[model samples]
Target: MMDQPNPVRVGHKGAKVSWRKSSYSGSNGDCVELAELGNSVALRDSKDRQGPVVSVGWRTMTTFVSALKGGHMGAGQA
Candidate 1:
């Protein structure tokens, strides 16, 4: 699986990363931030900038998003 999170801190690897969140996110500060890391994507909590970051392959992220949009995985569907 490409869903495992990298154990290093942000910018620790000296790679340039710009974190951004979905515009649909509410102003209540509940969302996740994403950064493009070459062939992979990095995800972090918007509320915890210094928290853990999960990195997944670009293709994996794309497929995951597609599943969400297609309603393949839902509340009770694993």
Candidate 2:
């Protein structure tokens, strides 16, 4: 069996991070913000820049996106 990495939680810090909206996002303004920190990637809600963040390794982020695209991630069963 392989070891699974624990989830990351990023929040409650006064530090500043440069976050940008995804280019693929629409002009509706409901989007997510992304920021890079060395090997880690941080994501947060565009509507709440000061809200909680979800950070993960660059590789992990890639895998997650892939899963999303492949329809491998979702709530419950379809």
Candidate 3:
């Protein structure tokens, strides 16, 4: 079995985060957004910009982005 990664701590209280939705996201209401802050990457719901943001390490974020591009998140794969 694979070990799950621990969630990283984030300070979204006053973060001047610049959120951007996924290019693959269409006119649909379901979409995720991302932002960069120092060595961390912030993730939030595009529909809820004012909601909570989750932060992760740069390396982890890289892996996530790669997986996303590879359609590992069930975005394009049928």
Candidate 1 residue lDDT tens string, 7-76 = 5566876667899999878999989899888878888999999889888888888988998888887935
Model 3 deviation from native, Cα RMSD in Å: 3.7
The lDDT per prediction is: 0.82, 0.74, 0.71
lDDT of 3 by residue, 1-78 (tens): 322344443444764656788777889889988777787777877887767767777888788779888878996556
The parts of candidate 1 lying over 4 Å away from their true place are 1-5, 75-78
TM-scores, all candidates, are 0.80, 0.66, 0.66
RMSD of each: 2.8, 4.2, 3.7
Instruction: Report the lDDT tens digits of candidate 2 across residue range 8-69.
Output: 45543765667788788898888988888787888888887767777777788888889887
Report the Cα lDDT for residue 47, model 3.
89
Candidate order by decreasing lDDT: 1, 2, 3
For candidate 3, the per-residue lDDT at 69 reads: 80
Full-model lDDT, candidate 3: 0.71
Q: Is candidate 1 or candidate 2 better by lDDT?
A: 1
Clashing residue pairs, backbone N/CA/C < 3 A, model 1: none
